[model samples]
Target: MSFSALPKIGMGTFRLKGNDARDAVKSALSLGYRHIDTAQAYENEAEVGDGIVSSGIPRREIFLTTKVWHDKLRASDLINSLHDSLTRLKTDHVDLALIHWPSPNDEVPMSEYLGALRDAQREGLATHIGISNFTCSQMDQAKDILGDTPIFTNQVEVHPFLNNRKVIEHARQLGIPVTGYMPLAVGKVMEDDTLIRIGAEHNASAAQIALAWTISKGVTPIPSSTRPKHQKDNLDALKIRLSKEEIAAIDQLDRNERIANPEFAPRWD
Candidate 1:
């Protein structure tokens, strides 16, 4: 499928485990979510696969994404781990496979691992390949390495609180898509009075307003929910058309907050 064919709303599987993971996937599928995101680091691909099976959604109808963890970015290790991920996912190939995080301390060169990722696409292990948690410089390095090969999307922490404008702009400049992870700011958006007021005006929840705001910025938001109500609510967020003033109001909510930063994360642009 074309990169532009990617769904506007995706169900994320971060921090979701066991029944929480399985049922959430099922609920999301039932609620018309065709994109599902998970990572090898998430340690629930088997459950996610089970949930997909239980949902009775045809595998061809779903856009599934899985990631290779940082520790496994070595070329051979990446290929091996992806094979293992496909085994766990009970699928021959994922719709997209990502480098979960950049090599910690650059122990593994981007060229080695990213080339292997491209090889996987050539081998039909992944329909598309991408990078996650990559900085602007890292993205440039990826471009230098991949050349004509496209990096499908840069999956990064993005929300009203952390608009991630720098990376988003760089990715867009390179003709890459930006997939916003943690689009709700990890529940903080629900407490923001501005979001609540906006939600009230639209008869929606604060979470829905935040999601709608995120989408308005031309980034795809993958908001996860174990509850069917919230899944439906988030899917419904796409229908919301924020006025220019409302978009500006939410734009003011950017505080440079980033939720997915780890000690080994690269220096931001």
Candidate 2:
């Protein structure tokens, strides 16, 4: 349940669906992406698996992750859902498995749902355990349920705009890595003059600069794209280190601009 060696740069497959999703995954692998993120809700685990297969990369070398849908929080149902996902993903085991969301109102108790995830680890379906879209308190509750099992990460939306400073700080204090989804804030980075200026200095795109900023803050950014150049540009950020002043300037752009929020998502206080 610990990810001491999880890749810092990974591909996020949230909105990528169908052939577009498949092509994106294949392109990312071709571009040297060793980590991939997908979920049952994304409806593209199969395509992701296809991309891995097409790339001819051995399954063990890629850090594959998938999630159990929010509706399948019951103990047995969650385990079964992961099994189905594994089948579609064409992999026997996932490097990481996360609870898609903290379904506070799900039929099962939090303990049961988290316990089911632990069971998945015991059965060798998933190697690590984590959660997504969880608020600070919800993460605490999840940890309580998990007990000694290490929670690998808490994947949440974090961009220069919607900083989620409180949650990020809390997670840092607890030593749990925060994986920043939508790190570019859905193209909002393109409009940020400060980030653009910094990118210009580094000869990188604003998207790359924003992604670098995420890693600078010790959070892993999972930016999704189907374009080969864009994906390659994203990976390039890992090599560019932003100066302290640049990091501070980008941090000043925080305006609570969150891009993804479903009606059922937990409200971040």
Candidate 3:
């Protein structure tokens, strides 16, 4: 998909499950969210699918993304897992499919998994393929493995508190876009004095300021919220333009406090 065709802000469904996941996705769609993010690891694809169907919106209007977990990075496992994801999503194809993370200890070579992901795209299971939680070196290896096939976007934990500069810089250098999950910093941004002050100037909430900062840097922010009001507030960040100074202030908040690093995660750059 063309970069312009992708929405800069999307609704995230990480950790949201069962009726809550379903209701949240439904509410997000009703609140004007055209992009929905979920993953096999989230274990809420069925609920997410139900919510999407219940939105009363045509499937063509939504941009859907799903990921294959780390353990399932083998060629056969990756392909089979995504097919299951498609079934659970109640869609024939996903706009984007990603390798949830690099294989732990390089157990499965990058070529194998990314090659399988490319194969899935050719099979019409995914319109595009990408990776997540990959460090700079891994991004290079992915490009080498995929050759001309594009890496759609790198979805990672990025927020005002953990700016993820290395990953973001490498993605930019490779001409790939980024999707910032946990853009609200898991409710931590709301307690920041600087973000609060910036929000006050824009008459928005601290979370909005954080989301706006992510957007200002050309990164798409998928902020998860179960509340319709909070979902609307997040989408509204698309409209709150931050000045250069405001953006700089938010940039300074990055202390490289990473989140979502599992024991098996690759060594970060």
lDDT tens digits, residue span 1-269, model 3: 33344587999999998999999999999999999999999999999999999999999889999999998989999989988999999999999998998899999988889989999999999988899998888888888888899889988889999999888988999988999998988899999999999999999999999999999888999999999999999999999999999999999998888778889988977
**TM-score, cand. 1 vs. native:** 0.98
Who is ahead in lDDT, 2 or 3?
Answer: 3
The estimated TM-scores of all candidates read: 0.98, 0.96, 0.97
Sliding window of 10 residues with minimal summed lDDT for model 1: 1-10
Which sections of candidate 2 miss by over 4 Å? 1-3
**lDDT (C-alpha, whole model) for all candidates:** 0.91, 0.88, 0.91
**TM value for model 2:** 0.96
Residue 24 alpha-carbon offset, candidate 1, angstroms = 0.8
How do the residues 104-184 of candidate 1 rate in per-residue lDDT, one tens digit apiece? 899898899999999989999999899999999999999899999888899999998988888899999998898999998
lDDT of 2 by residue, 202-245 (tens): 99999999999999888888889989999999999999999999
- Candidate 3 C-alpha error for residue 267, in Å: 0.8
| Candidate 1, backbone clash total | 0
User: lDDT: which is higher, 1 or 2?
Assistant: 1
C-alpha lDDT of candidate 3 relative to the true structure = 0.91
